[model samples]
Target: MASDAPAGEVSLLDSYSPDRPPVTAMRIDFSKTPLAPHYSPYFAMVIDSLLTPAECAAVIASAGSNWRDLKKGDSWRECEQILSVSPDWAKALSERLAPHLPDEIKVLKKGDVLSEHIAGPSNLRASQGTSKTVWRLRGADERLSFLRYRPGHHFKPHCDALYSPGDKEKSFLTCQIYLSDMPEGQQGGEGSGGETRFWPSRTGMGRQSKKSGGVEEDEQHTENESFLNIEPKIGRALVFQQRMLWHSGQEVKRGEKFTVRLDLMYNHHFEKPSK
Candidate 1:
């Protein structure tokens, strides 16, 4: 059963502290599917309370600076107007600011920064042989995109763009931070219905193929029995590999939803694992 701690408190990963027992946010058993056809059960988790309300508010304000009419892949540039969400954002502020902030407000300024590893389970960390507490990993993240979904807006079913088969610096995972949901005590976007849906295997989750070959998913599998629907909540983040997961963003029925989508890149070689 879900807890009622707050409007958007994450009950699972946040329960353990890093000091007393060194609890980790990454979980290996959040979702499993050996026959997923394309993805590995390697890591996919929805972490709650990763960000504070104040931090989310800052992100909301940051994204509001410039909201592009979200576009599909380049192959369907002509149909770019079809997507109802905001395209992307200006820049990633956390990586650029995390080093200078104090301990108290540091987490708020860099929630997504910590998210890089928290979303990626396994002892393999966001660092390479560093005893320091805040070691930025060598790879796994390159770009951070801010997605805004307003009333009647949404993304169709589709997976992320695949790298050049074996590009050492390709994006292998997609990380999303749910910046806003409902009202949450009068501090967020309005309306509702911005849930994310995913299909287990090659099910397509009942959605229709929109683009010819560039990977622009549409929301068409409304009645499919083989998909799972995940609702958006403030300060929650969803991470998964796009190589195998077929997903779509549900249309906002009433208000708006803000999400920070970061492209987790990959690097084959590393100095060594963190100590």
Candidate 2:
């Protein structure tokens, strides 16, 4: 996704002091596809009490003067800001989340700087090496983004895009920690509609194509349909993979809603055989 935050090394550690409180978050896995008729394992879960109320406040305050209004047409309309944390801090967070996460996503090391990997060409050259590569969790994205939504703010239905720092390092999962809660029953925009909703995936999970005058034309699918509604709660976090999932942020109604989004970075390397 396109970002508006100023480039270069913008560390959040400069502004916000991170506090280490007792790890209190507990993971609640979704046994089946949300709002779906048939039973199917889902790659998303809610980690309750991931942060304390004070921690959430500290993160929101960390944005300070960095908040950028990223409103564009109907696709995305929300305020966003970014801050990078120290590798130590990121490692600490990874440890806290380790018990709840699957083995495949275990953080093994810090990731490369965005410029060193993302903007550069793929480091993996077929001529140099040829080993089967599998994505192994490295750490979180260096720059963590904070999103704010006031009344009438929202993001349209769209799938989260993968951020490939290098051919060996890419992001496939998203972790969004909620800072403010907009509970249910509050009336304003479609029954207090600041909830994150997920919809059914399209066939092949790809764009549609139609033949026009013997030429095929690509049709971009655009719709805000959803059946599952995840209401915001202070200290709650939503973690999901960026595969065929299509979701949106429903418009905020009466109050303000805030969230901190972090992508899980992974290193693509040849798997080592177990002894």
Candidate 3:
């Protein structure tokens, strides 16, 4: 992968566009925790050892093209729509985009329901029971920006804007991959305070809490503890529902924190398509 801004399509729909770089060689090795029943639909899973230290560094260097100021948004307006306008061409284009989507989107069906859940590159039209649901893989911005939190650089608690799928049946997903983490483990890398803190789920009846300075205050944790904080492990990806989860990155205290954030779009499967 060339580091400079992707030489291909780099927009919200880039992954599904013909000009987008081919990601078919990539793999999704999901963690066991993100697939649990309680975590389904709204989850954040991590996969370790996918990239070596050097490869991770190369990707960062390649992002030199249009690295812009990374900021947090409270909401995302409807961005765009993707249809089978060029039926044959779009289908082929969708194939290239599938692999980069979230790995697990457990179909919650009690029995085999023959409905298409275009959420995965595998079993795209399968007849399986509950499966993992991670990335919607609908569409995403191709050009990526790196967020480097230096000492005292921090983002406050907030929910990512829901990308207007132009349809209510669709939602979005977010992926955070660490380019570099502070404290350098062997250097007694206790890990900087750059952990991504996730609040309780807002859908149905999930955990409820407020964020003070981006740090979530969960009733589940003791007064000394705040919300659930996941360390930014190099090569580990943190994937979760973009709108459903209230999350924030903590302030960097000791060293610097670098991360690449990508968004995924797809159908929520609330309804089946009309024949």
- Could you say which candidate leads in TM-score? 2
Give each model a TM-score. Answer: 0.55, 0.68, 0.53
Worst 10 residues of 2 by lDDT: 208-217
Report the alpha-carbon TM-score of model 2 versus the true structure: 0.68
lDDT of 3 by residue, 1-275 (tens): 21334343322233334443323223322223342233333444565533445546755654553433433233111111111112222232234334544444433221222112222233233332444322234544443435676766666555555444354223345666676867854465555678887644434433232321222322232355335677877755665655445566776777777776655445433334224
Candidate 1 Cα outliers beyond 4 Å, as residue runs: 1-42, 71-142, 163-167, 183-191, 203-214, 217-222, 270-275
**RMSD for each of the candidates:** 12.5, 8.5, 10.6
Between prediction 1 and prediction 3, which has the larger lDDT? 1
Model 2 lDDT, full chain set: 0.58
Kindly list the per-residue Cα lDDT of model 1 for residues 1-275, writing each as its tens digit: 11111122212222234432321244324235432443433346666666555667765554335445654454222111111122122123234222322242111111333333332332223344443123222323423456677766767667666343353344545667787875433336544677887754444433333542326533345464465567797776676655546677877776677777765544444443234
lDDT of 3 at 54: 57
Error of 2 at 266 (Å): 0.8
Report the CA-based lDDT of candidate 3 relative to the real structure: 0.46
In candidate 3, clashing pairs total 21
Clashes of 2: 1
Off by over 4 Å in 3: 1-41, 65-140, 165-171, 184-191, 201-225, 267-275
Whichever of 1 and 3 has more TM-score, that candidate is 1
